[model samples]
Target: MNDSDDDFSRFAWHTAEQRAAQGDSRQVADLAVELTHRIEAAAEQTRDHEHQLAHLVRVLAITPGHDSLTQLLRLFTRSQGPGVGLAPRFVASLLAEHREAADLVGPLSERDPKGRLDELRICLLHELILRGVDVDAFPKTIDWTRVKYGDHPLVWLPRRRSPLETRVVFPSRAINSSAHPGGSVLPKEGRLDPPTPRTQERSALVDTATLDLHQMIVSAPEAGGWGHSEAWVFRADEEVEPDRVPALLPTLPMGCVEGLGATSRFEIARRPADEIWSLLFATASIGIGHDGAHGAFGRLWAWKSLAALSDAPADASAEEVEHHVQQTTWFHFESDAEWFCNEIFADYGIAALSPDRRRIAVLAATATD
Candidate 1:
């Protein structure tokens, strides 16, 4: 080897050994990138190229730096032959980051064969969700199965059970409130029934909205866990005027807020007022759930019914009110109302409006009278 190449090899080896011994992942990643370059250059002349490359891959796999992981993935794609396998553990680790997994989607898909590509993508998706990516953005048709992460097989997605036969019972005051024009048009018990199946394709706009909502929800401190009962209710009246929505909603100087684990950025889409309202309601109440359940489905129907109620006259009948409430109810049992209020509503200035557009209810578990 030439003097310059020999010097580089020596430096790479020394750095790798030092960083590995110290367990410095960032420094190890840096050294791994340098070694990758050396390995590529010496591919034709060096007999030790495979050993060097293997070491580089191993270091990069364990490194927490996303840039280093990306470089390693790119190198693996370029250098490894078709028959060779990329390390599943390495791929899984890198995919634990939302941005990294998203970046890999196209490249991994293009490089690996169909079945292998699907497997890798599935693994990446699984990790992304676990890391708090929005559930609404997940691919709808996932054939879930366990893949080996190390010695153990890991399940990325579990099959959901059949929808529950349930109803949403509104508070007596809320049912009798002028928010519903028709007197007691709802069931005698003031409950909203479950929604019918929807055949319409979800809009891409809704997808974007859902992603934002997911980020906001997951970033909140108290968002995760089962049986969270906190909720907020807000209302906006037609007399308020559509142009005032921005002023009425919360505003952050840069449209971003920092919470417990991650920073959340939000933007209200410039759509018609009604469309925007519906989109936000649907995305927040139903689409943000980690899994499909009766609660989410019921919330979707409830929002739709609320929209219909907004159009009904104030003197609407009990049956009419019941019909609307039954059309929509809370579906997400795991929803964090405090998180929604603090992170979503408080940050974004969102208020939930009654069907008549006369009242906004901000229900939250943390709310104090």
Candidate 2:
């Protein structure tokens, strides 16, 4: 097929996958079953053509390692029909079934078990957060396979757990504020309880783990303005004067706010520290992408502004959040510095904003150096 056809095909495939993930049974069943038949056909053809070394290489070249493995598994259970795999495709299904079952549960015995285990754990954790589970109440551990509901392993549960967890999961270091260990959460009373200051203030950083997207805009305007006309602009560097920008620099700008002229706007209000953490983490993990590595690092750079703030609290008063317009190693595209500012402002509002603190500090440090 041509490039356009290929693009369309990929989009269609991804659409199917997304729907399946969201529990669209019809799409999941149809695609899963159809894909299985294709896989079996390819496998049989490969086996028959193995005698021709050139043909084998060609077959292998066209099939990614992950695709080949998935096909093998799908073929084994073909008799159940195409739609069947959707019901019991992975360990999460088992957990959902027997969340309270009594049995020894462990990660499945699979090739590249570590990778599989991590995916499962992340999925479960995200699932929990989405269900409004207070992530802070449960400390995170890497023992996915060891989980048990009563006596049965989590993988073997007959029914999914009730009351799914809803708080988004993110890397712990992302939420570690200089204010305290494991970071501090503001109570509903609007108190400031930060984590103990870090020994190396220079290293303090904020990221997806410490920010919450939902809470940031729950009652705010739909789009945060960047003092620019372009809707949905997110820039690291721009032509405008630094003083004119209205949001955080060096962070992902909220396109929804800027581009769409969202009616939601930031409000100056006290938010629970836990809520802030959940929003950032959820945005970084879920809203970014399925393969969110680039987004993660982009978030890390955004946190660098926070790090600068935390590093020298004595100097926080002199800093301003800065941005470099040119795309560097952080992200590949051009962004709107103004939009970035709007997102941060929309997230926290202007009353409690601290954009200038980091800017002042950076300038002072540069002068000293």
Candidate 3:
């Protein structure tokens, strides 16, 4: 091998070995990319190319992505010890952050003035909500319109509204004071009557509810599926103290928040709130709606419902709760959501009375209130 090629190979090998030793999966995942290049370069003349390819294959298989990539990096790096270099860690962080942005943006553009301004505000509000922000405290009324693209008249449009931006909206006190904290709109009892299984499968987007809400949210969507790279709407709801935040939503910009029924200038769609809530809640699970019908609204609702329930709390039997509480999956998603929801409710000093108390209070408040 020439000096430069040999130098690249040696550096790649050394970094891979260091990451492997340090147990840095993030580094290892990155090294997987580097090794891809090395394997290509080595393919032309090196006799050891086969061995290198096998090793690279093995590395990719061992790495886990369902869990937080950051956690994966921490565990892998800690296991490998301090001798590992810092370069892989930096690269891993950047790639992960960029991927998250791509997932949220979802083929959106900033070229159109109106679309650009709206997207920016949406992102800014989303950020504020992430930090336990109170948009209600903001003075201006935020207006957003849901636009369709690649559908008839708008097919050639430059900036199209994302399914999400078209659906979720800011909570106005006059409208959504009693809206569900997350995207869920379960009955006052917070219990589903029970879902009867359907016989036929529909479109990939519509029929994707075969898996549980948590599974759908945490797992990657198949090719040409919902096109959602990742779902992170579920935040801890239990930890926020009373008055600290209104609600710790499982997903921010709750999918049901989109398109108010108001006769305002920024009306996106004319769907009703109860209908939107019902459609999303049911579709995420059994994939049904209030009228038990199917439509684009159902699909969108299903997606957000799953995202919301990824953080839904359960009051399981003592034995079941105890057994599940110890499991890694349970600890990560189930418990985390429960704790998050509880914290948010606590922070807001939302009373934790029985369903009877809640129902009476909600009933007492006028629709305007």
Candidate 4:
């Protein structure tokens, strides 16, 4: 390495990261461009290449777009600590944040044949969706199991409206208010008839997805301990209205809010169905809770929960996921009322009516103390 490279290796990038953290967007972008040059020009056969790449990977957080994504992926292998698996998350975030990164996902299995990029693949899909790109429109990458969710793309084009094959019973109002302090649609009796066949089937899928979420595989994050999640299903007596779900949800029984008075009351607001996955993925995403790879549990849970709710097979595709979500009438809720509370922050949930409106699935999670 030359004297200037030595100066950068010893002092420059650290200050770059510090400046980036201190709100220097220009410095971050400039550092990313510089690091890409240094890392790319270094030969893989060079004795110090991996060492140089490993130490400099930390600067990725300073910027995105022109960050040394592909180069770093090929050269870096070490982590700051054992079991950290920090590289994939950084690569994933860099990919998601980079304006030109969307093209990288279509060739998953070959690019990451050993599955090193799994979680990043999932997050990139998410970020692209947020950008309003039609991910299902991407060319079929045949037989790559996990990214497909379990199937090939099916809902790439909007299907003509048809009565759904799956159905659920419409809920009766246990609480009538949609204002501050929402009310439950659960019966005052606080119980339902025996579990329906639909419940058993969806639960089986959920259980299986849950198991995968708990695995300590490369790039896949474990189940999160920072929040509480639960599922409750009820048979509807009438047609369930999706817009009214914020009031009809069984928030009290779901432990989303404390029921202190004679009636269960908490404030709740509905979020767009397309938006919930990102909102859930955002929980505890920075600083100590989600340092690099560790904070990934949130995204895993978000992906798994929605997939399970749709009864999506392990190989289900993004298009099919879109179809199922459209078939199902679901509400994603955000609340700050005293009754709608998490251990340390606001609580949110999904109250979904099975396609036929015969079964209602209510799933909720709240950050804990």
Which number leads on TM-score? 4
Predicted candidate 3 versus true structure: per-residue lDDT over 240-289, tens digit per residue: 33221112211223222223122211101112233333333232312211
Give stretches of model 4 more than 4 Å off.
1-55, 60-71, 77-86, 95-99, 102-225, 237-253, 257-260, 284-288, 291-301, 310-316, 333-345
**Candidate 4: tens digits of C-alpha lDDT, residues 241-277:** 6554544553234344333232423333443344444
Deviating ranges (above 4 Å) for candidate 2 = 1-104, 107-118, 121-266, 284-369
- lDDT by residue (252-303, candidate 2, tens digit) is 2333223422222321223432243233333333222131221222132223
Model 1: worst 10 consecutive residues (lDDT sum)? 178-187
Each prediction's TM-score versus the true structure: 0.23, 0.25, 0.19, 0.47
lDDT of each: 0.35, 0.29, 0.28, 0.43
Model 1: per-residue lDDT, tens digit, 164-191? 2122221111111212111111112322
Whole-model alpha-carbon lDDT for candidate 2: 0.29
Could you list the CA RMSD of all candidates, in the order they appear? 20.8, 20.5, 23.0, 16.8
TM-score of 3: 0.19
